[model samples]
Target chain A: MDAVAAEWWKLRSVRSTYWTLSAAAAVFVFVLLLAFQMAHIWDGLSVERRADFTLRPLQELGGWAAALCLAVLGVLSVTSEYRSGMIRTTLTVVPRRGRVLAAKAAVVGTVALVAGEAVSIGSFLGTRLVVGDRPFPDQGASIAHDLPDFAIVGASVAVFALLGMSLGVLLRSTAGALVSVVFLWHVLPLLVFQLPEPWNERVGSVMPGALPGQIAGRSADSSIYGDLLPPGAAAAVMLAYALVPLMLAGFALSRRDA
Target chain B: MCGGPSRTTVDRMIEVRELTKRYGATTAVDRLSFTVRPGTVTGFLGPNGAGKTTSMRILLGLDAATSGEALVNGGGYAALRRPMREVGALLDAGAVHGGRRAFDHLGWLARSNGIGARRVAEVLEQVGLAGVARKRVGGFSLGMRQRLGIAAALLGDPGVLMFDEPVNGLDPDGVRWIRELMRSLAADGRTVLVSSHLMTEMELTADRLIIIGRGRLIADTSVRELADRFRRGVLVRTPRPAALTAVLAAAGGSVESMPGGALTVTGMDVAVIGDRAAARGIPLYEVTPHSASLEEAYMELTAGSTEFGAVAS
Candidate 1:
């Protein structure tokens, strides 16, 4: 745990991570406003429904933010080390490569969760002020409020970040890991959904992005992910996706040289 | 028996014994063994592809040996709880994060090792990189990058240190500074093992040398002892080769003729060569002691035994 705390300090001390999180915040706010503007285009029943209605759209926006910010957070967190050859330096300080990998994984996930949640809440509130309380529920009654959505999406962001981190660790090269996770987490899942019906249903449940959607709940397109996985199932899948690379990387770390 | 030097001094002796590394059919290191003691610079000497880098990597736990082991503070580098505090090594100056600022790069290493954040600044200054500490490492010249690497190695202030080819690309002044740095580090009772191909450079820096060729130990000796035992004969040049030759013949000395009216004299000292020349009134142009350079002697000794000669490397 001391090693883990040390790893955390190293991660947070870097400027690249702050810039990446800031980018995510800026993008999340921009997209939240865009989602709020789109809410006006849809025909709704009542002002009350409209106020309550923004929750879904905001949730969706937050989910997408969680999903995409991973591309930045995950790649930058681990692959940036590779790009700078800082991983070797990191390994030198903590030669138990397994412990180092775990420390990095834990650090990346926890930071992403916190950063992702902060960015989501800031963007949600900033956009709420711009979009008006009348339409998006300044009522502040339901857990569907910005705070809960922030928690859920924060978890989703953490999942994606860990997923990306796992891929980064599995593939030591920067370009290779980034390209692989982008394809596996983003492109491959899209390609998999377009496949034959049962295949899409089956594969979507296990894909990395599926974890985020399961946590946030699927849209009308829920069928696209084989009868929307329960939050528990999604969490399990997320843990699985994150842990496989971690374990493989750990084994490789121990078996092979640093 | 190979407890090495870590036991005696404040330094943790890095002991590599019977360490062998192989890649498929190619045997890279063959039962190589040596001890790097603290309080003196131990030079890891070898020609190109002589497995100096491989051996260092194995010792640092960056690469696994095919057999045997390397111990840092009585355990493998990977087993150490605080590896940087136990063993700090720079296998290559180029093995660094070029995109990171020098201070940030070293800072991360410091953080991981549980060292104080202040050590980063101190080490950066120690390596003369305080001015460029915030600059991107990619922009540094090879010498500056070497300094950054040294800074990283020194971040934890560990007792054991290893560097391979640390002077690969440096101005003469930078090279001299590194030599002095190694000596000073050793003077502080830290175990410092440095590797270089240049014997002259090692001659100035290393208190003792571990010379290897073809992944095998050639000699583990000191500079003066090497010079004495190698027995490279004295050189006596003369403007009158025939006169010197006859004088050598009468004096029970052997003189070998050279193409440029020179004589390679054996079985005599420079003073004797000078006295003989003076007595015969033969003008002596040069009477220099031509001790075989450790590099040349090393080459001659390993001439038939190198693993990387006459092969496309």
Candidate 2:
């Protein structure tokens, strides 16, 4: 419990925490504006072009940017200490290194959950506000869609934040961890899509790029791009990305000298 | 070892036995053994790269020992229920986030140890940083950072305190302040181990000195004893050198002629030599006594063990 409080204090005391969270929230609002602008332009397009306009993925876009922000926040949680040489002080205060990591994980995960839910839900509601009145061709397919997708966006972000924690702990360098997260989340999927035929579908589906559709429990309306894991399977896979690295980080942290 | 409050009493002592730490093939610390008892500041003296910091890190549980144990109180530092409340260490003053305010840095450390916020304020005030508590640490000077580090160490009011070069990069006033702080902490019956590569820093402060060289213990004795053991001899200069030398030799004082016509005499006090010289009717020009300092002793002790030495061509 003391560890938790200390971690909380550590997370909130830094300027980067507020800066990154605010930037993520700003991105959410900007993406909402962009989504609404696209929705407004849907009426002027021809039938073929109109069919291509899908608003569901627009809600997920804001979450994507927010995940990037949270990932940076998570990486900084540990890497900042290393950069500042605060790890020695921290470890000195709490000799059980594992407990310190656990507390950091909890704090980052909690902040990510709260901030993620707020930004994602706000994006969804804002999109609804702009596009709700003007009905598209195939609207209102399921009434239950809004809340679940909203919740999923928040969960996906929180998971990414946890993944950042593990990477930060493992790398112990800010630029190194941040680059690794970028490679895993963005660059890996781009390379995966370049693979030949069904292999692209097979690999890209499990990558973080397919997370939005997998987490939303449905494919995007624009294109049937690849073979995606089922919702439960996708959730498990996403959870693995966070949990596996976290476990490894905890083990290394306990065994390795500070 | 038996465990309980009785064990706790024993645990309050910092004991490092056969502690060895090796990095790859290079042994940083080899079979180092020592105990820091309460009520006095034990100066951990050594030249640079003498394994002083490595041993202290092991004691703080920041680094794992390859073989042997470093215990605070009676158990390992990790096994302590409230480590900060039992042992406080200022290993590196730079181990603080610059973006955070000074108060927040110590405040978080305080919270980690379950110490009250009021204690944080008290320590900041104690370290003379209370006025700048809200200021960002990025703007703080190195001396200020040191004070903040000391404040953090004192937050828990621990029984055992360890400082690695606590006086480094400090002004004369700051150095005196830390000296006084260490003395007072020891006076309160708390165990204190302060490490410094500079022997002069420890000479005035430490009661007992643990001098190491090349990761090996050289001497563990009182500060005064070290000075006595390494005393160079009294140097005497006289206008009537031959007569003075003859009288000093007759009086059982070994004398060696130094450059520029001064005689270095040992095994006799300056007063006795003066009395004898007066009795012999020898004209005394200059009589100066040279006492070997802790710095000289330390240099002599670690002369061969220095990792890097300037070669005189």
Candidate 3:
């Protein structure tokens, strides 16, 4: 309990925590606002069609925006500590490596989850104001969608931040951790999607992105990916990617001399 | 020897037994043992890379010991239920969040082990950091940061305090302040362990000294004893050197004849030598007492075992 309190105090005391979360919130709302404007866009389309347009698509965009929020939160939670060299001090105080890591993941994960839910619900309600009495997207077709569950968002952000923690500990360089996180969490997932055949598609299908799609649901015109496994499985894989390194780093910290 | 690390009582603090640390094939601290008693300033003296820092880190549980043990209150540092209140240490002055304010940094540390925010302010004042309590530590100079580190260590008002290279980059005034601070802390009946390569500073500040070289213990004794063991004989220069030598040698004093017609007298009282020269009709040009310092004595002691070799004199 004391360790958790200490970790929370440390988390709240830093400007970087608030700054990164605010930036994420601003980006999220801004992107959703843009999504709204796009839904109601009247520049090119016919006047009749423009008036007939629905705001349901903005809801899908909201999930993407939330993912971006997690990325920022995840990076800041771990990378900021590495940059300032506070990790050593933190480890010195706590001494329990696994507990420290768990406390950090819990705090950052909770914050990210709350923020993600706000983006989901805020964009869902806010976008509804611009488009009224519209038919929603298909329920079954958007196989991997996440429906703004605080649990899902919390899990996703927790995993991402955990991976960042491992990278910070292993590399001991903020720049290197940041680059590797950006590459491994975001770019690698994208590259996996590009691989030829069913294997590439299979791997990309279960990546971190797999969860958000389930909540957003598919638009009426989209093809059904109903064959895909549930978001829970993909979420598990994403978590595994984060947990393995975290475990390795914790063991190494205990065994090695600082 | 127990299932977990132990915590020693404040009155009977640390016992380090054969503590060793190595990085791969290169040993940083080798089979070193020393006890730091309560209510005394024990100086940890060694040149750079002689394992002073490594030994401190091992004691703090920041580094795993290669072999042996360092017990605080008769237990390992990490095993203590409340380490901060038992043993407070400052290994690095700059181990703080750059973006966070100083008080906030201390606040979190205070919150740990059930300490309060009010104690943080008190500690800040104790270290002369009250004026900059709200300032971001990133903007603080090295000296200010050192003060802040001291504040962190003093926050819990622990029994045993360990400072590694406390006066490294401090200016002369800062150094003096630290010496006085250390003395004051020890005066309050706290165990203060200070490490430094500056032997002269340690000479005046420390009550007892533990000297290390090549990651091993060299000498652990009182400052007075160290200077006494390595004290050179009384130096005397005289025009009638033969007369002084004959007179001093007649009194059972070993005499070394130096150039410039000077005579060095050993194993005899200096005042007696002066009186003997006067009585023997010897006209003495000069007779001076040569007081040996801890730095000079340390140089003589560790001349052979300095692992990385001494810096050019």
Candidate 4:
């Protein structure tokens, strides 16, 4: 508990934490403007063309963009310590390396989770309010019905945060860990999308961005992701994305000298 | 500044025994052993790359030893639940995040050891950093960072303290402040181990010295012992050199004639030589006791052990 408090104090004391979270929150404003623009364009489109326009992408944009921001937050939390050589002081104070990493993961993970939920749900609601009564093809679902999916989307942000911290601990370099995170968050999914048929959908089904929809039991027909896995399997994979990397990071931290 | 009494009854000692550390093929610390006791400042002296930092790192559990034990208070540092309360260390003053405020930097460290925030402010005031407590460390000079580091070390009021090259970039006033602080800490019955490459610094600050070279212990003795070990004889000058030499020799002092009609007399102190000369009615010009300086003694001890020696032109 002391370690957790210390880690929380350390995270909150730094300016980078606020900077990254504010960047994550900026996605909300961007989504609202995009929603306003989409509503403006919806009025000009003929009824037939209106059936094709969907707000799903703008709704998911908040959580997706925040994943990158919060992940950067996660990366800096550990890598900054390494870069400044403060890791030795940290280890000296709390010699149980596992506890230190766990405390850090706990603190970073919780902040990302809360921010993720806010941005994800906030974007969804804000966009819906702006495009009120438009009744687009994909807007038929009630707020209560789509709320679970947005919640899962928020949870995915925490997963990305843990993954970023793990990479930071393993690489101990901000640039290296951020490159790896960006690869996982944006680049690899795009590359996976280009793979040959059944394989493309099969691999895309497990991508971090794709997991939220799958876990929420939503069909991925209009999206780049696939809907192959059952909800349980998708949820398990999401948990693995957060846990597996953290376990590896813990192992590496304990075995290596600070 | 002294705080409350230490929480533990454990004898405050830093014992490193047969400790060895290796980085791939390079040996950093090799079977090194030393014990630091309370109530005195023990200077961990070594030339650069002589494994002084490496040994301290292993002791602090920041690095693992290849084989051996570095016990603090008769146990491994890792086993201490609140290590900061038992052993405070300032390994590198620059190992701080530039973005953190001076108060917050020490604040988090204090929180880690379950120390109260009041102690943080007290230590900041003790180290004379209270005015800049809210300032970002990025704008601080090297000396300020050093004082901040010392404040962090004092936060928990630990029984044992270790500092590495703490005076590297300090002004003369800061140097004197650290010297007095170290002496006062030792006087308070706390074990203090200060590492430095300068024998002159240690000569004034350290009661006992542990000199290492090439990751090996060169000399583990007190300042007085080291000075006595390197003592040269007394030098005497007189117009009647032959008379003085005969008088000193009669008094069982071995006298050698110097080039300028002077004599180097061993086995007798200046007082004995002066008395013998006065007894013989021989006028004495000068009688001075000579001993090797601690800096020269340190150089001779670590002559070939310097890792990055340059070839003479």
Candidate 5:
């Protein structure tokens, strides 16, 4: 419990946390502006032209900006200690290395979950207010509805943050961890589609990088996702990505020298 | 609470027995064994790459030992219910994030041991960092960083303390301050172990010394004893050195003529040599016992054990 408090204090004491969160808010506002503009011009558009308006405000704002910033947040929690040599001090104080990792994961995971939910709910409500009481086509989903999907978006952000922390422990270098996270999330999604037949579809459904879209109800064409899992099952798969690596990291940390 | 002082008494000692650490084929610390008892400052002396850091790491449970035990207060470091209350260490002062304030840097460490935040403020003042308590550590000079590290170490007010070359980048005043701090900590009955590669630094601060070379123990004795062991012949300066040399050699003392009309007389004491020279009617300018400095003694003791001394071709 003392270790948890220490991790909490450590996470908030640095400027990078505030900077990254600010950047996340800035990106969320950009997405909000685009959603508000689309709601204002809904009357002038035709049925075929309106099909292109597929922005799920909750996912678009929280998924892209929050995932990227929270990844940095989680990765820096461990990597910064390694880079500064504070890991020696930390391990000396809390010699059970697994406890150290657990505290960090809890803190970063909580912060990511809370911040993600805030921005995603904010984006959803802002769009709801803009498109208020309008008799529109089927494209505009009511903000008062779809609460479960919004919760999934927030949970996905937390999972991504945990994944980043696990990578930080495995790699133990800031540049290497961040690069691996970016490659796994951004680059792997684009390349997975090139595989042939059932293999692509089978791999795509479980890909953690693409699960954010699934959580947001923006599942890509059947060719990209193959056969999409239900939202709850998709969340569990996304969670496995964070949990499996976290277990490996725990085993390695206790055995390896700092 | 800031000025309150309590000298707690506890069995604060470090014991390492047959401790060996090997990376693949090369052994970093080879069968090393030693004890650091309370109420004295034990200087852990070794050259660079001599496994001092590795041994300390293993002792603190930062690294696992290949064999043997390193126990503090009768148990492993990780097993202590309140480790910060039992041991405090300043291994690397620079291992702090520069973006953090001095207060927060010590605050987290204090929190880890269930120490109160008031103690954090007390330690900040104790290390003379109260002025820069709100400043970022990144902008601090190396001296300030060392002080902050020391503050963190003292946060829990542990019974046992260890510092690895705590004087590395300190100025002259800072050096004096640390020497005093080590002595005071020991005076309070705490087991203080400080490691340094420079024998001169250890000579001024340590009450007992444990010298190692090439990951092996060379000597575990006091500073005074080491200097005495390395003390050689008596240096005698005289007019007509040939007469003194003959008298000294005739008196069963081996004498070697030096360049400045002096003789290095061995196998005899200064009193006996002075009397022999006086009996011979030889005029003596000076007679002085040649005792080795800590630096010279350290060199002579570890000469064979130095891992990377420059080879003169």
Candidate 6:
């Protein structure tokens, strides 16, 4: 518990944490602007053209952008220690390497989860306000009905944050961890999307980015994701994304010399 | 000296038994064993790559030993809950995040061991960094960083403290400050282990010396004992050198003639030599016992064990 408090203090004392969260909040602003543009375009369009317009992508954009920002936050939480050679001091004070990593994971994970929910839910409401009562194709569901999916979207940000921290622990280099995170977060999904036929959908269903929507029982037909798994299996996969890497990282941290 | 309550009910000792660490084929620490007890400063001296840092790392539980135990207070460091409360260490002064303020750097460390925020301010003030408490550490000089590291070590008021090259980048005043601080910590009944390659620095700061070369213990003795082991006899200067030399030789003392009417007398005490000169009615100019410097003794002890030696031109 003391270790957790120390890790929390470490996370908040740095300027990078505020900078990354600000970047995540910037996504909320961008989503609102895009909503205004969408509303303007909707006003000028005929009813036939307006039937095709949807705000679902813009609503999901805030969470997606936040995932990247919080992931960087998670990466910096561990990698910054490694970069400054402060890991030795940390290990010296705590002595238990596993507990140190667990403490950091707990702190970074909570921050990411909170930031994720705020941005995702804020984007949904902000876009709704800007495009009030427009009745887009995907806006048919009531706000209460759509809230759970954004919550799941927010949860996915925590998963990405944990994955980023795991990569930081394993790689121990900011550039290397950030690059690996980007590859897993963005590049791997795009590459899997290009695969042929059944394999593309089969592999895409398990990708980190796709599991959130799948777990929320949303259709992935228009997106670059696959909708093969049921919500239960998708939730299990999302949990795996957050846990498996952390376990591997913990094992590595315990066995390797600091 | 910020010696809070005495937490010395424990053994208050650092022990290494047959401790060996190997990096692939290279053995960083080879069957090394030593013990540092409280109430004295023990200098851990060695050349570069002689495993001083590696051994310290093992003792601190930052590195795993291949086969041996480095125990503090009769247990492994990793097993200690709230280790900082029992053991404090400053391995590398520069191993701090530049983004953190001086206060926050110590703040998080103090928090790790359940120490209070007030202790952080106290330590910063103790290390003379109170003015820079709110300043970022990135802009600190190397001397300030050393002070910050010391403040962190002293945060928990641990009974056992270890410092690796603590005065590396300090100016003359900073160097003297560290020397005095180390002595005071030891005087406060703390087990202080300070590592350095410079024999002069250790000679001034340490009471006991554990000299290692190539990861092997070469000499483990007190500073006075080492100086005595390398004693160079006594130098006797007199106006009648021939008369004094004969009298010393006759009195079972070997005398070697030196430049300009001086005699190097061995196998005889300064008191005996002075008495012999008086008995012979020979006036003596000077009679002084001489011992080799600790620097020379360290060089001779670690002569061939240096891992990186340049050939003489």
Q: Give all TM-scores, in the order shown.
A: 0.86, 0.93, 0.89, 0.97, 0.92, 0.97
Better structure of 3 and 6 per TM-score: 6
RMSD per model, one decimal: 4.2, 3.4, 4.4, 2.2, 3.3, 2.2
lDDT of 6 by residue, B1-313 (tens): 4344655444678999999999999888899999999999999998888889999999999999999999998889989998888888999988988988998899899999999999998988889999999999999999999999999999888889999999998999999999999999999989999999999999999999999988889988999999999988899999899999889999999999988878999899999999999998999989999888999999999899888754110
The fraction of correct interface contacts reproduced by each prediction comes to: 0.51, 0.82, 0.59, 0.84, 0.82, 0.85
Interface RMSD of 4: 0.6
Worst 10 residues of 4 chain A by lDDT: A218-227
lDDT digits (tens) for residues A1-258 of candidate 4: 999999999999999999999999889999999999999999999999988899998999999999999999999999999999999999999999999999999999999999999999999999999999998788898999999999999999999999999999999999999999999999998899899998899999999889989888889888778889999999999999999999999999999888
Per residue, candidate 3 scores C-alpha lDDT tens digits across B1-313 of 1112343353447778998887889888889999998778999998777888888888888788889998887888777766778778888887778878899889988877678889998989888889998898999999999999888888778888899888978999999999999998888778899998889989889999999987899999999888778777888988788777777887899999887777778898678987898887777777776667777888887887776555311
The residue-by-residue lDDT of candidate 6 on A1-258, one tens digit each, is 999999998998899999999999999999999999999999999989888999999999999989999999999999999999999999999988889989999999999999999999999989999999888988999899999999999999999999999999999999999999999888999999999999899999999889889888989999888999999999999999899999999999999999
Model 3, residue B63: C-alpha shift (Å) = 1.1
Considering summed lDDT, which 10 consecutive residues are worst modelled in model 2 chain B?
A: B1-10
The C-alpha local distance difference test score for the whole of candidate 4 amounts to 0.92
Which one wins by TM-score: 5 or 6?
Answer: 6
DockQ of each: 0.47, 0.82, 0.61, 0.88, 0.82, 0.86
Candidate 4 local Cα displacement, residue A51, angstroms: 0.7
Worst 10 residues of 5 chain B by lDDT: B1-10
Q: Which stretches of candidate 6 lie over 4 Å from their true place?
A: B1-10, B309-313
Model 6, position B174, has a per-residue lDDT of 99
What are the lDDT figures for the candidates, one per model? 0.74, 0.85, 0.73, 0.92, 0.83, 0.92
Which ranges of candidate 1 are over 4 A from the true structure? A13-15, A39-55, A120-141, A144-150, A212-223, B1-11, B237-252, B259-262, B272-286, B304-313
DockQ measured for candidate 2? 0.82
What are the per-residue Cα lDDT tens digits for candidate 1 across A84-180?
Answer: 6566666767777878778878888787877777766656665555555444453355435445645665666776787777677667676787677
* Tens digits of lDDT, candidate 4, B95-204: 99999999999999999999999999899999999999999999999999999999988888888999998899899999999999999999999999999999999999
